[model samples]
Target: MSAATRAPRTCSIDAGSVLEQSDGSASGIGGTGHNAAIPSSGIGGTGHENTIPPGGIGGTEHNVAVQSSGIGGTGHDTAIPPGGIGGTGHENSIPPGGIGGTGHEPGVPPGGIGGTGIVAAGTLMNVSGIITAEDYTKKQLQLAKGDQICPGDTIATNQDAKVKIQFADGAILHLLKNTEISLVDYNYSPQQPELNRSLIILAKGDIRSISGKMSKLNPQKYSFKTPSSTIRVIGTDFLVTHLLQQEGALDAGTYTKVISGEVSVQSTTSTIRLRAGESSHVMLNGTQSIITSGGGTCSVH
Candidate 1:
C-alpha cells in the first residue's frame, strides 16, 4: 500500500452515482483495480476489501430504495422496494371508474346507466314501449312519464295505444295507432343548432321519425305539419301518415315515408324531392303524388 496510498489506475465520476452493497463488494483491496463502469444495472465494483451502500430510492415518500448491484449483496431481492419491475406491488390498478378497465362499459362513470336508457348526443332520454301524454292547457289532461311537452302541444294515442315522443336531440317519435300529433313548434338545442326548430302537426295518425341529434345539426330545421303540405327535414328516417283520403274530409292528406333521409314535399304550389326508399302523396285538393314503394300510407289496416 505504498506509492503514497495507491488509488488511481483511472477513476471517473461523471455524475450519476448509485453504489450498492450485497454482502460482498470490494472496491480496492491492497491494489490492482477493475470494477467501475456502472451504467445500467450491476452497480459499480472493484476491490478495497468491498463495501458500498448509499442508495435507497424507493417507496416514494422519499424513504428511497432503488438498488444497483455489484455482488452478493442485494437488498431484499436484488431490486425490491415496491415489488420489482416498475411496481407499486400491484401493476398500476386504478379501475372502478377513474377508468382503467371494467367500469361497466359505455364511456365509464358519468356516461352510462345512471339514467338507464339513452343519453349523450342521441338524447331521447326515456320513454319505454307503450306510452301516453296529453295535458291540454285548457281542459283535457292526462300525460305522465316525466311529462313536459310544451309549445302548443297535442299528442294522442288510443286503440292499441303506442306513443314514444322523446326529444332532447336524440330524437325518436314513434307515435302510431290513432295518433294525433301537433306540436306547432319545438325548439331543441343540442347545444344550439343555431336554435334548432321542429314543427310537427300530423293532425291525424302515424309518425315515425328518428332524426335527432337536433335533426342532424339543422336539417333545414325540420317541419312536417300536414293538413295538406309542408314536410322538410333533410337528415331523416321518416314516415308520416295522415289518411281519410276524403270520405270524411277532416284529414284528406299526408303520406310520406322516406325511411332514411331527405324530404321536401311542399304544396300550396309545388316542391318535391323525397329519396331513400321514397313515397309521397299530398292532396288536400292540391293533389300531387310521387311513388316508389306505393306511398306513405292510407293504411292496410
Candidate 2:
C-alpha cells in the first residue's frame, strides 16, 4: 500500500501589500515566467496544473475576498479610500437582509430625512428679478430701486390699512396702519443663539407679532422697543401698539394694548403686567390700568 502525497498549497496573499520573496529567484521572481508563481494558495501560483479560482483570496464560501487593483498592495474588497465615503456592503444570502444603511421596517413610517435646506419657507425677497423673469411660474414684485428698504429702513403701517411682512424666521409682523413703525435692526442666525437677535422700534404704529421658533428658544434675543415702553415676550403671541395723544384733550395718555398673551410694559416709572385684551396707560405721573369685566380692554390712567 502506498500513500498519496499532495504538494503544499500556497498561503493566501494579502491584498493590502505585494508579496516579497527572500531568495527572489523564481520564474516570475525578477522575470515573467508562468511557472514562477507560488501556487494559487500563495502569492504567485507556481504549478502548471494548478488553477486560480474566481474568488481567490478569502474564497466565496465566506463571501469575502482580496480585491486587487493590480497595484503593489492587496486591498480588501471592503477597503474604503481615505477621506472618501464608503458604500454600504450588503448581505445577499439572507432574506430581507442588508448591511449598514438606514433600513425601513415594515408598516412603519421612516423618520424624515434632512434636505439641502436652501431657504426656509416664507423667506421674503429671495427671488431675484432675473430668476423671476426666466421662470414663468416664479412670481416677481418690482420694488423700486429708490424705494428699496435697506437693513435699517423704517416705516409706520397705516392704521386704516395694515400690512404684514413675513420674515425668514417664520415670524409674522402685522403692521397697524397710520401707526409709526421703524425697523431698528433685524438679523437672524440659526446657528448661533446669541447673535440671532431681532429688534423693532415702534415709534407709533401698532404691531401684533407671533414669535417664531427661534425667538421661543431664546426669549431674551427678541425685543419690541415701543415709544413709551419695551415689550418682552417670554413665549407667546401678542399685540403691541403706540397711540399718540391729541395735543389738547381732556386727558392724553400713552396706551399699551395687549391683544393676546402677557406682555411686560416698562414705563418711565414702573413695570406693569397686562393680560390678553388688557390695556395699561402710562401718564406723566406714572402707570395705571382700570380693571374691567372679563375679556374687556383696560383703560389706564
Candidate 3:
C-alpha cells in the first residue's frame, strides 16, 4: 500500500495483556485482575501489585504495599500513614487543621489549657472613700468594694476612709479611718484545718476583728501584732487600736478591748489575759497594764 493510502492496522489484547500507546504509556492488568494505566507524564492506576514510577501520581488502592512519591495514595483500610500530609485518615500525623495527635496543643489560641491565674487571700467586702492597697513592690492599687486582697499587701485608707475585709475562712475585719494594716501571712485550707494560719499587723489604726476558723481550729497559729504587743485570740471578737504619740492627745500604745470570748496580750516583759468587756494597754516600752476601758477610742458596734 502507498504511504498515504494505507489502511490502519487494528489489534485486540486480552484482559491481562499489555497495551502500549504512542505517547510511551502502557495499560495492563495485575495478578488480581485489576487494571493499571501508566502515563508518560507519571500517573499510575490501582492494583494489588501495581508499580508506580518515582514521581508518579498514585491511585486509590486499598492495602497498598508501597506508597507513591506523588499525591493521593492511600494505605491499608484507607488510612494515610504517619508522614502523609493531608487526609481524614486515622493514622495521619499531619492533618490539615492542627499539628497535634488529638486536641490542639497547649497555649494554642481560642481555648487551650495552661495556667492557673490569680488567687485571693481576702476580698474587700465594703469600701468607702479612697481605699488603696500597697503591694510588696510599694505600687498602690486602688481598691473597690469587691476587690481581692493578697498576702504581703498593706491596706491603707485616706482620711475618713474605711474598708471591710472578708477572709477566705470567714473572718471579718473592719478597718476604720486612717488605718494601715498588713496581711503578713494568711493560709486557710478548709480540708486541712490543722494547717490553717493567720498573722496580721496593725501598723497604725483601729480594727475590729471577728475571729475565723483559723482562730477557732488552730488558735496557736493565729495572732495579731502591733509595735508594742502580740495579741492571740481564743475564738474572740475584739477591737485593737495602735496610736502613735501625738502632741497631747492619744498615748503611743497598743489597746485591746474584747467584746466577746477572750484575748491575751503579750508585751516584751509581761502577758495579760482579758475577757469580754475588759481592756488592756501595752506601752511602747513593753510595760503591760489592765485598763477599765478602751477609752472609747475604738467602737465595738
Candidate 4:
C-alpha cells in the first residue's frame, strides 16, 4: 500500500464539556418571630406610667430595635447565625450525576469492564489497506486504520500480514500474520488511578506487546488471557503466540518469550515466572512448563 493511500489512525476522546452550575439554589431561612423585648411587669416604680411599644411586646418582622424602660431589660437580636447557608460553609457530597463519586469506590466496577466510564484504547494505524478488525461489543467487523478501537474489539489479520496499533496509553502492538486477539478490558483513567485496567486475550497466532503507562501503574492487573491460561506482565515488552492444533496431548499451544522486564504465565496446574532471555509454554492440559535451554530464541512471525 502506498503512503498516500494509507491514512493515519485517529483515536480521539472528547470529554463532554463539564457544564457546572455555579448558581445552585439555596433556600432562604428567616428567623422565627415573637420575642418579648421588655418584661410585662412593674417593680417599685416612681409613679411611672406604662407605655406600650409597637406590636405590644411582639417583635416586628425583618428587624426591630427595642430599648429597656429604665433598669434592666435585655434587647433581642434577629440575625441569621454565622456559618449558615446564607453565609459560606457547605461541602456538597452528591453532585448532579447521582452516580456521585470518583467511581473508584469498591464494588464500583471500573469502567474497563464496561461499567460506565468509557474511553477509546487506540486504533490500527498505517494499514496495508486490507486489515480488518471485529468489534465484539458493537458487533461490527468493518474496521481499518483511523477507526477507534474499544475494549471489546477482536482484530484479525491474514497470512503475510502485519498491523500496528497505538493505544491511548501510549502502548504499541506490532501484530504478525494469522493473528487473532481481543482487547478485553481497557480503561485508561490517567487522572483517576483506581479506575484503570488493561486486558488482552490471545486466541491464536503471534503478536508483540509493548507496555504502556496503564500497565506501569498496576502491572499485576494488566493481563493476557490465552487458550489454556493467563499471562501477567510487569510493564515489559514481550512476544506471545497461541497455536491452534487438533486435540492432542502434550502439545504446546501457547508460548511466551520475554524481551525485556518480566512476565508470569499461569495455568490451572502451575505458574512459571520468566525474565528477559527466558521462555515458557503451556500444553493442551493447561500445564505450564519452562522450556529447556536449547533452541532458545525469540521467533514469532
* Candidate-wise lDDT, in order: 0.45, 0.37, 0.56, 0.51
Residue 141's lDDT in candidate 4: 47
Best by lDDT: 3
Please tell me which predicted candidate would have the highest TM-score against the true structure: 4
In order of listing, the candidates' clash counts read 23, 21, 0, 0
lDDT of 3: 0.56
RMSD of each: 28.9, 26.4, 29.5, 22.2
Task: Please write out the lDDT profile of model 4 over residues 144-237, one tens digit for every residue.
Answer: 6676676556787788677888888788888888888888656565665444567788898888999888788867667888888788888889
Worst 10 residues of 4 by lDDT: 81-90
Off by over 4 Å in 3: 1-118, 247-249, 293-301
- lDDT of candidate 1 over 128-157, digit per residue (tens): 343443322232434434444543346677
Q: Give the TM-scores of the predictions, in the order they appear.
A: 0.26, 0.44, 0.58, 0.59
lDDT of 2 by residue, 208-264 (tens): 777776576666757787656666665557766565665554234456556566666
**lDDT value for candidate 2?**
0.37
Model 3: clashing residue pairs?
none
Error of 4 at 88 (Å): 35
Error of model 1, residue 282, in angstroms? 0.8
